[model samples]
Each structure stands twice: as C-alpha cells, then as structure tokens.
Target: MTQELGPLAREVAMSYYEDALPAHDRFHAKRVRDVSIRLANECDEPVDRDVLSAAAWLHDIGRPLERTNEIDDHDEWGAREAAALLEAEGVTSDRIEAVACCIRTHSIRSSSPEPETLEAKLLFDADKLDAVGARGLVRLACIVGERSGRTGERHAVIDDTSVFGTIASDQPDISLLRKWARERLDRLYTSPGRRLGESRWEFMEDFFAQFDAEIGVDGKR
Candidate 1:
C-alpha cells in the first residue's frame, strides 16, 4: 500500500487481496489500521508507522489457508508469511521482524498480555477493537458473502453445516458469533477504544433487539 514497500512487495500485496480474503482479513484489518492510528496518538509510546501499519494490513495473510480460519493459532502463519512477503518487498530487517512479531502474537492464545512496544500496543489495541460492534458485524457479513452464504428463509442463523458455514465452526453458529462478540466487547484495552467502541456496541445491541422484536420471540404469534 506504499511506495516504500517497493514494487515487488506492492505487487505481492495486490496478489494477496485480488484472491478473496476472509472477512476479518479484508474489512477488519483496514478498520484496525484506522483505529491504530488514532490509538497511537493518544498513547505515551512511539509507534513505528511503517511497522505497525504494514503489520496491520498484512496480519491476516495466512487466514485464507487455515483449516478453521479461526483466530486460534493463526498469528504464526500470518507473521511468518507476512515477514516473507515484506522482506521480498525490501522492508528493513528490524522493522520486518517487529511487524511479524506483532502479527504472530495477535491471537488471544499467542498474544502477550502486555504490549512490548508502541507498535505492538497500537496493533494489539486496534485488532481487539475491531471485534467490538457495528463494524465487526458488517465485517462478518462480508465473510459470509465470500462463501456465497445464503441464510435459510431469508434470515435463518446459519452454522457450520450450512452451505457457507463459518470457518470458526468446527461448527459455527451465527448467533454464537454475536454472543462471542458481545463478550469480547468487554475486552477492549485502550482508553480511546473503550470510549469509541461503546456507542458502536450499543448500536448493535439496539439493532438486535429490534430484530428480535420483529422475529417475534418463540414465534408465539
């Protein structure tokens, strides 16, 4: 996405996106980059614009290849793969490694509880914030679209067994994702994220509430 990443790296990055990306990889990554910039400003630490920005963009490079496409155990592949891609594009060794480390450790299981540097903290905060609300839900819809997913009867909650079953599903439930997102909302780390994501989450909550009202609980009618 930059002239600095050079011709080869830029070409590779283009190739990566031309082929389809998992929902989070496509939309959420961009969203994270946007938020990471804002977070970088508020924090006391100094974020490496090149490192953090590149990492943010490439963080999900391995996602399309993963069997589950779940966040679990995903960071390493993305990190290693991203490092190779970046290296080919002429990114500096230290910067490349730093970006790769952030990518590799972004998963809940893989991530350190603490951000080791400004880039790490900014990336970490941004990625987590991506899961919080309206944007996150829209990103999920895009993922479903990649699978050509069509819900049964116009609004059925599709799961892993469904034609476009979510990768998270050894069996995935659309409702389950909504529930999990609600839980993760409480996981936002940075101050800006806490404030920024709240309204987004509240909007989503209201949308679902109206949806339930329309669906008619228990179909009692």
Candidate 2:
C-alpha cells in the first residue's frame, strides 16, 4: 500500500514545500517519515505503514498557506487537503481518513485534534522529535535567524566548531530554543519516543552547558 502511495504523496508534498522555509521544507518531511518508520518498527502493536507514510509526507503541505496567513491552522488544512488529494488518487475512504487523522493531530496546538490511534501517536511523536535534538537546534536557529534578520551570522555561528566562543552569551533565541525543547521533551507519547527524546534532550543540555561556559554565561568560567 505504502509502496505506491508513498511516492505519490511525497511528490505532492514536495510541490507544496517548493518555496517553504528551511525549517519546514520537504527534507523535514522526509526526516519525519524516516523517524516515523523507525519508531513504528520498535512498537509492539501493529502500525499501518501506508497511513503513516502518507500522513508523514503530507503533514506539512499546508505550512506555506499558514505562513502566508491564507490559513489559520496547517494541521487542519493539510488534513482536509490530504483527504481530497488521496480521494482523487482512488484511495479508500478509511485509509484517507486514517491519514488525515494523523495529520490533523500531529502538532501540539490546543486547537489541533488529539491523536487517537497508534499511527497518529507515532506520527505526532516523529514530528515533535525533529524539534528537540541537534537537528531541532539547527531548525530553530534558521527560524530565529530569519526572524532576527541575522541569517548569515546565525549560520556562521552554527558552522563554527567553536560556536560557543563566537556566539553571544545573552542571545534571546537560545533561551527560546531551550524553552521550546523542554516543552517538546515533555510532550512525547510512546516509550520509544520518550527514550529517543531523552537522549536527544541530554545532548541539547550538554551543548547548552558548554555554550554557556565558553561564553561566561550562567556564572560559568
């Protein structure tokens, strides 16, 4: 099932992400797909790979619309759009609904639907996993850089092996990223997800600790 729909869904998702931000680009979707499959393999319960794959690929398709204020919620919008697109592709109603349900609740917004099924929970965990690790820092850096009008500076800081030495100690973006990462760490659902997230969270903490020490922040010498 996924063998056919996966490629088709990816192609459709790519079109939507053609001009997307670096943080939420098509590659981000691909990473989420990989994580979803990996987590699914570790689960004791059965998972519908077809629904998971389709949902992972199409999850962020409405991001561009949301970014432009054309839509208020990408998850909800993407779910509806995915259902229509899958229906057009001759997918069964149940499969389309399954995929849509996963997309509709992938994010942790208050208004977003709660993930009810194992597939949806996996998708949710996979998506959030990208927001807390080394990759998560890079994504947040890209976003913060873009917002602060310092993309080149932020890239330079990230590219440096001695980034701590070069980075500003009091940058608000770093604080924001830390806060967001902590929140994401607490939001993980599955046991496998929690295990993976805990490891990543530790890495992030170590990185930040070193960063603080190098820059003489947090009273570190």
Candidate 3:
C-alpha cells in the first residue's frame, strides 16, 4: 500500500497545502488518514484499505475550490475530482467508485448521503474527529484568525490580535461554543470513533473549564 499510494497521496496532498488554510490543508488530510486507518483496523465490519486510503487523502482536495466559491459543494466536487485522479492513477474502476463515495459523504455538514459503507463511516469518523480534540482547538484558532484577518502560521500562540485570544476574552460566547462541541461528540458514527472521541471531548471540556477559571469567568458568567 505504501509503495502504491504513500508517494502519490503525499504529492496530491501537497497541491492543497499551498492554497488551503493551515488547519484544513495537507496536514489535516494526513491526520484524517491516520485516524481513519486506525478506525478501519478496529471496525467490526470489513473495510477496503485502498479505497479508504485514497479517499482520506483526496477528501479535502476540493476545499480550496469551495473556499474560493469555484464550487458550491466541496464534497461533490471532491468526489468527482477524486474519481478522476484515481482513474488516472490506474486504480480499478470499482475502487475509484468506492473512493468517490467515501469522499462524497464524509462531510457531516454537507447534504450528501450519510456514510453507508464501512470505509465511508471510518473516513467520516476520522475526518470529524480532528474537529473536536486539542487539534480541534488549534483548528478553531486558525479559523478564528482567518475570520479576524490575522492569518498566520498554524501553531501560533494566542494573542489579542488572534482569534483564540478574542475567544478567550469573550467568556459567555465561548461557553456557548463549548456547549456545542460537547454535543457534537455524540454524533460520531463508528464505535471506535466514539471511543476515541470520549477522551478528546473530555479534554476540550477540561480545557474550557480551565479557560473559564483562568479568565475569571468560572461561575458568575
């Protein structure tokens, strides 16, 4: 699998690195791939490794286009783009279709059909998992920075000019978002996904609690 895809997927992923946001770029795809593979190994049902691997790498390839409004739906565009890329890579037609399906429905926000196959579910789980952990906090920070016109390196520390710093200063609002994150943890599909999410979810909860206390908004507000 490494010989066949390790390089190609990395190359394909690099195409998005320069254009996409730091949080959702090639590195995000790699995290999803790692989590997806782990879930696939722990799944109760059988999952096709090739399809999952390809889909994980290609799933967010269309994010740049979506952000630019070149496509209204990243998932749809990603599915089509992934299919074409897989075909060009000499992957089997059936595998290409399966990979496309995984990309099409991996998004929890999109109107695309829910993940039906084992591979799709695992990919979905892996992808969403990144949005809830400590990684999730950092990703949220990047998003906040982007919205506030303060975009910079992925791992920048929080500051007044940064989004996370703004969030830290705003207690009541951040509390609401923390509530939303807590609820979202229940939405994980696969058992392994949920199992993995538990710790990340708790970590977020604890972080926010500490955040509230440190910021002097622990109980009153």
Candidate 4:
C-alpha cells in the first residue's frame, strides 16, 4: 500500500511546501516521514505504516495556506485536505480517516485533537521529534529570524549578546519558544520517543548553557 501511495503523497506534499517557510518546508515533511517509519519499527504493537506514511507526508500541506492567512488552522485544514486527496486516490474510507486523524492531531497546539490511534501517536511523536534537537533549534531560529525580519541572522535570536545579557531581558518569543521545546520532552507518548527526545532536550540545554556563558549571563566572561 505504501509502495503506491507514498510517492503520490510526496509529490503532493512537495507542491505545497515548495514555497513554505524554512521551518516547515518539504524537507521537514521528509524528516517526519522518515522518523515515523523508523519509530514504527521499534514499537511492540502493530503499526499501519501506510497510514503513517500518508499522514506524515500530508500533515503540513496546509501550512503554506495558513502562512498566507488563507486558513486559520493548518492541522484542521490539512486533515480535511488529506481526506479529500486520499479519497480521490481511491483509498478506502477507513484508511483515509486514519490518515486524517493523524494529520488533525500531529501538532503540539493545545486546541488540536488528541491522537487516539497508534499511528496518530507515532505521527505526533515524529513531528515533535523534529522540533527539538539541533535541527529543532535551527528551525526555531529560522522562525524567530523570519518573524523579526532578520532572516539569515539567527545569532540575533539564538546567540545574541544583547538578548542573553539578562534573564529578564530575554526576548519574549525566544523565551516562550525555548520553554515550548523543552516541554515537548515530557509530552512524548512512546518510550522510544521519550528516549530520543531526552537526548535532544539535553543538547538544547547544553547549547543554552554555552550561549549564556559566552554572553556573560553566567558571569563567566
């Protein structure tokens, strides 16, 4: 099943993500799909790899629309879009719903629906995994830089001497983003996900520690 649907899904995802933000581009979808399959192999229970693959590939298809304010919620909009796409591809209704469910809840947003199926949980975990480690920080920095109209100057957001001068003076967005990434370490639903997330979270901690030390925030300079 995946052998057939996977390529089509990738083709569709690439079209939507071609002009997406750096943080949520086609590469991000590929990473999530790869990680979802990798984690699925380690699970003790059976997993619907086809559903996971389709969901992972299509999960962020609506992000470009959301970025342009064409849609209010990417997760919700992506779910509906995935359903229609898969249905047109002649996928069964049950499988389409499973894919839709995974897309609907893959985000970390509080308002997003909770993932109930094993495939949904794995998709959520894989998506969050990409938002944590070294890669995660890079993605976050991209978002911050883009938002501040300082694209390509990530140091201003992640390693700025001014921003790190004092804990109280840290930019609110970066602070909230850091807190959000750290909290994902605990929100993982699977043991494998937790193990991987902890390692990534530790890297993030070390990075901030070095960042602070270099900026004299720790009084070491």
Candidate 5:
C-alpha cells in the first residue's frame, strides 16, 4: 500500500514545502512518517498503515499556506488537502476519511476532536516526538534563526513564543529549551510514545544541566 501511495504523497508534500525552511521541509515530514510507522508496528492496537502513511505525509501540507495567512489553521487545511490527495489516488472513501481525521488532529496545539484512533495517536506522538531532545533543539534553532534574520543566535524569537511562555526576555535559552522539552514530555499519548519521550526528555534535561553548569548558571561552581 505504501509502495503505491508513498511516492504520490511525497511528491505533493514536497511541492508544498518547496519554499519552506529546512526545519519544516520534506526531511521533517519523512521523519514523522517513519516514526509513526515505527510506533504503529510496536503497538498492540490495530492501525491502518495506508491511512497512517497518507496522514503522516499530508499532516503539514497546510503549514505553508497558514504561514502566508491563506489559511487560518494548518491542521484543518491539511485535512482537506489530504482527503483530496487520497481521493485522487483512488483510496477508499472510508480510509480517506480516516486519513483526513488523523491529519486534522495531529497537532500538539489542537484541542477539539483529539486523536482517538490508534493511527491518529501514533501520528500525533510521532510528530511531537520530533520536537524534542537534540534534534528538536536544532529545529527550533533553525526557526529562530529564520525569524530573527540571524543565523544560529540560540535566542528565542519574540514573535514566536511557543516554548518560552511569558518569561522575561533575559531568561537563558537553555531554560526556554528545557521548558519546551518538559511540555512535550507531558503530552505523550501511546505507551511506546511515553517510553520514547522519557528517554528524549532525560536527554534534554541532561544536556541542559551540562549547559547550565558550563555557563555557571543556577549558581553552578
């Protein structure tokens, strides 16, 4: 199934992300898709892999449009886009609906219609998992650099305040990064997700501890 749909999905996804920053491009989608498939394989629950594959590939389809104000919400927009793509591929309507639902609610910030299906949960978990630990830090740094018009300053952008909360501007980057990792850890859903998240969270915590120690923050000698 993936052998048939994977190429089509990737082609569509790549077109949308053509002008996207490296952090939010095809590589990111591929990682999320791979992680989602892995989690589905590990889980005892029954999941439709074809639906999962299509959902994972189209999850971020709305990001570019949302960034330009052409759409209000990326998840909702992406869901519509995924449905169209799946229909074009001759996927069954029921399966297409399942895929669309997964794309619709895969976001960490999404509130309504939370992921109930195993496939959706895996997609959500996989997507959030990518936003933690070392890779997550690298991704955030790239976004920050893009927003700040500077390359790798390690400072959170004022306009993009998702991780930093309402803290003072003087707070260290390590503190902000730690806060984000903790938040991500708290949001894991599946058993495999929790296990993967624990290790990643610990890695982030350890990295921050070492960083603070080197910088002499928190009264470190």
Candidate 6:
C-alpha cells in the first residue's frame, strides 16, 4: 500500500518554502501544489498524495536559497534538496525515489526533460499552468518584483522577476500583448481543465479588455 502522507506533505512544504533568508517560500510551493492537485484531478490520474503533494510542495525548496543569483533556473536544485528532506522525513525509500523523480522534472524548459510517470507530467503541467492563467498573472508580478542582478549561489533559483513583475505593475514596456493571463486562461490541454479554466479565462479577458482599450492596444473606443 502506498502512503498518502497528507499532513506530512504540508509540513515538509512549510519547512522549505518558509525561508528566513529572503529565500522563496511556502506560498510558492503551495501554488505549485495547487496546480498539481488540479491537474491530477483533471487528468483522472492517480494522485500519489505522498509523491504529488511532496513534489508540488517541495518543487521550489531551493528558490529562496539561491546562490547563483540568476533566479531563472533552479529546478534541479529543488529536486536535490527535496530528496534530502523527504529522506529525512522517513518517507519510504520507493516513494521517496518517485517523489524525487517528479521533483527533478518539474521544470519543463530544462532542456525538455521527459516525465516518466503521470505524476511527473501532472506536476510539470500544473507548475506551467500557474504561469499562464490569472494565478500565473499574479505570480508573474511577483517574479518581476524579485528580479535582481546575477550573484554567486548554491541553490538554483528562478528569474521570473522581469516577466512576473511586469505583469503586476501593469507596465511591462511591451504593448499589444494579446496573449495575456486572460488570453491564456482559455487554453487547457485537458477537458476538465477547460471547464474550470475557461470561465476564469473569460473573466480575465473581460477584465483585461477594460484596460486594453484604454491603453489603445486594441484601438477601441
């Protein structure tokens, strides 16, 4: 029997994401987990609460502790740290391994690392999904807010600061962006996702249109 490891997931997630040294924190992990859970449900995939939850929660463990200062690439670092943490938590060796697999491949743009299991794919999709919708919009803003110049570091970090911050500030310097959060909300690879994501996407489009015309991007009114 597989371990559900429900509360354990939350506890582990908190331990890493909530950093005191300006490191990325649990909120980001939770958002990743949120996307993973949603994808799992939508895909009718077996959600290994232990693996999925742990991976999702631990996905960004290395973010706040970045050493390189790049803040744009850190998926591998997160995987390494997450493995250590899960092993410490006494997760079964097998489950621990599976969790590691998912964590390792969570980042999609890492040279197209292939996900072997459904869990990995779900986590990957969820992480990216969060970056494309309204929620993604908020994350983009945060990314922009955190962008700093390069630095020496140990843990891998992300560089979403520019794109992310631009979204939040509403001044990304790029005009005529027809494919924004609202615009992306309508696109889902799965049917269930479309059901939940479509309405939200529509709402975002409407909200964005309010500012779009005012900005003269669409040249309306």
Listed in order, each prediction's TM-score against the native is 0.71, 0.85, 0.81, 0.86, 0.83, 0.68
Candidate 5 residue lDDT tens string, 1-221? 34466566776677888867776777889889998888888898787887788788888888877766799998988888888876877777898789888988888774646898888889989988887878987876675666555454446532333343555564245466567667767887899988888888888878766764663443323
- State, as a TM-score between 0 and 1, how close model 2 is to the true structure: 0.85
Task: Order the candidates by lDDT, highest first.
Answer: 2, 4, 5, 3, 1, 6
Tally clashes: model 3.
0
Query: What is each predicted model's overall lDDT from 0 to 1?
Result: 0.64, 0.83, 0.75, 0.82, 0.76, 0.60
Model 5 C-alpha RMSD to native: 5.2
Candidate 1 per-residue lDDT, tens place, 1-221, comes to 34654233334554455444556555566677778877777766556776777777777666655634454455777777778877776677887888877776665542434556667766776786676677677665655555545343233345324444334434444675476566655655667667776777788778677655674444323
List, in order, the clash count of every candidate structure: 1, 0, 0, 0, 0, 18
- For candidate 6, the C-alpha RMSD (Å) to the true structure equals 7.5
User: Which is superior by lDDT, 3 or 4?
Assistant: 4
Ranking by TM-score: 4, 2, 5, 3, 1, 6
Cα misplacement distance, residue 200 of candidate 4 (Å) = 1.2
Model 6 reaches what TM-score against the true structure?
0.68
Between candidates 2 and 4, the TM-score winner: 4
Query: Model 2: residues >4 Å from true position, as ranges?
Result: 1-3, 146-173, 216-221
- Find the candidate with the highest lDDT and give its number: 2
Pick the winner on TM-score between candidates 4 and 5.
4
Model 5's TM-score against the true structure: 0.83
Instruction: For candidate 1, report its TM-score.
Output: 0.71
Clash-forming residue pairs, model 1: 169-172
Error in Å for residue 206 of model 6: 2.6
Task: Give the top-scoring candidate (TM-score).
Answer: 4
* C-alpha lDDT (0 to 100) for residue 118 of candidate 5: 87
